[model samples]
Target: MGQHEKVATSLADAVGEEIGASLAPVDAELERLYPGDPGTRQPVHTVYVPGDAFAADTVRSWGDRALDALDAHAPDAASFAAVLGLADDLAEPVYARVRAKLEREPVEDLRVDFEDGYGPRPDDEEDQAAARAARLLAEASARGTAPPYSGIRMKCMEAPVRARGIRTLDVFLTGLLASGGLPDGLVLTLPKVTYAEQVTAMARLLEAFERTHGLRPGRLGFEIQIETSQAILAADGTATVARMIQAAEGRATGLHYGTFDYSACLGVSAAHQASDHPAADHAKAVMQVAAAGTGVRVCDGSTNVLPVGPAAQVHAAWRLHYGLTRRALARAYYQGWDMHPGHLPTRYAAVFAFYREGFAQASARLARYANRAGGDVMDEPATAKALSGYLLRGLDCGALDTGEVARLTGLTRADLESFAVPRRGDLTASSG
Candidate 1:
């Protein structure tokens, strides 16, 4: 009964998914990855620290610094409390906990970026960076500091950087093997992938790495960045996300959108490189349709705005991040990139608010549909599944507790657990 009770606390119906983080394999950020309270708090934001600054000791302190910033610029938790309809005294404690979480684990997924974050470094410098990143990976593994989802991002395999990207990956993998082997849940990020051939090439490279390192053939899975126009629309004017996944030959784990780059490819001016631009919507819609049942997770990009002003002025940045995150959540893109510490509070606030606002209606409707007892309105299987997903997401993100989910959905813990293990096809099926 004790074991069951502990295990049942999980969002039993939540599916395995990936979130985005682009960090420079620097020391300050790394040490913080495994904070003091690993399970007490979870990070909603992904840190994007530059590669040049990545150091082992320094990486460890990034989380604490972010927490300090959160405390310093503690935005009026007014909006957060208002959305949940909490009183001032109660909300103050809740906000304090949120603030504590920001400091404890501000980074959920850390991407040791060698691409844009690293930029173009000298060959020897890039090689050294790869080596140091490998060392950090080893240390993180030993200390249990690696995030639940973590890895490195190499330069694009298109154009002039293809050879360099391959070399960087080779060096990094070699170093990782020598240090402590690949960590569990490590994903490689291939940025600006424009053709099926690039993905196929990466698959071949990963296979080679596995063989050379004495690992299994498919040990490494990679994510493709859908940044360019070609990645979205091929020369024949067809959707490419599914095709790229197919070319990955089962090595494709996720697809991430590069908001600014994609917009630039569409010829949108710098001023208009916004997340909600119609161009992004069209591309993401296509991505959702093409990769629906393939199990390839899709991640939205981060906002460029940083909260650098005084506490009074920081809420604007918070509001922007909150709005963007909310938009992504509404579209079912739960995971996204977080570029700054300010984004941490808003990320959780937006997610919790979204889940809390619709909880009662969604739970009632899902219960009625699941029981085959029609309620006030017609409920289709698809709607039921989406409703179930909403509740599951709430549970997964800690927005709703397992007990609350059970009460609202009338599902036992085991039933909730079963709801979380379905394949994409099963989850999205027209009939249950």
Candidate 2:
């Protein structure tokens, strides 16, 4: 028995050293790039308009028009409320809140699209459009009508259009910078990136723009469109998103999904290209995983169900758009593309309802977990983090004010403000 006990053991105990020391640099990198909380404000939806159609008051005008259309189409907030599955009594109040938000901050983000929205144009016409867009952007900034997040989307840098895309972007940026420099929250959108080299090239171009405009090194970040199958899945089935990010060299601020293009690449017909399609989900999931912890925001694609035509048609379209937007919100993809002015109201409505409906239960669950009440309910750390995030999102999107969030969550303004980064031991405690 003594001899058996004295037998050699292959297991070894960990030495007295810092296990995370070697990972210090890696952790620092991940934190620097994608901190537990990215303090940037993400809009509910980004309204995309043709480049030539952009104007200083586009967002405000769109909001006003959307409100009128909503009023006329629904005849009462309750009419649309029925569509949203909200209570009849709550409809007017919700509608008022959404209307106010739209008026005050009608567009949180705007993409002056030059790709699909603008389509092909003569070289001269394109340049003129770019210049006009630049002038309007400056006017919007001066008039304080520019959305918090505003930028332009250039054509894809692919063959037969690479030179044209770069020219349009250059012309636009040159004119924009001439007015001063990149406006606050400005970001360019690069479409159809099939390889990492495309992102690297765009980064270099952005760096040049910064230098030429006498702006900061990272002032000109861009959002890449994950449209083509090649962008989401390589020939060998390896994800191309991480490679794209690495190539961007920290200039990739966002990744936007393009439903139709991605679906077309998957051989899906026009009828099948939809925001909630499995193919779109697969592309966005790849985007989420690759861009996670990298500070690159992921945006869901737009719904093609535009609210137009007769009243019944508009209602039908609104219902579809509302459903798609809600689906995106439930997936934690807050930002999306809004194709028309009518989508503005529905966008805000869905976001507000999402918060309002979940507020009470989320707050109670969070408080209960924090207080260790253990009322047969439990939440993981990720759940707690997400709960806080929902509130933060509400506050950022103007759905909830500081006072409201404080009262609802029983957290101070400061605590709610730093909800992005929570204390490890106490989930309610913020580490701002």
Whole-model lDDT values for every prediction: 0.72, 0.81
lDDT of 2 by residue, 1-432 (tens): 345555676544443236567778976776566544455677787788898788777887898888888778875677779876776656876788887886788888888989988999999999999888887887788777788888889987788888888898899888877887668878789998899998998988878877877787887889999988889878887898878988988788889998888899899989889989888888898999888767788999998888989988888888888888889988878889888888887888888888877877877776665566776666766676677777878888877777766666678645544545654344434443
Question: Model 1 compared with the native: what TM-score?
Answer: 0.81
lDDT of 1 by residue, 193-252 (tens): 889999999999999888877888778889898999889888897887778978988777
- Report the lDDT of model 2 for residue 25: 93
Report how far off residue 91 is in candidate 2 (Å).
1.8
C-alpha root-mean-square deviation, each candidate: 12.4, 5.5
How far residue 194's Cα lies from its native spot in candidate 2, in Å, is 0.8
| Worst-scoring 10-residue span by lDDT in model 2 | 423-432
TM-score of each: 0.81, 0.89
Could you tell me the lDDT of residue 330 within candidate 2? 89
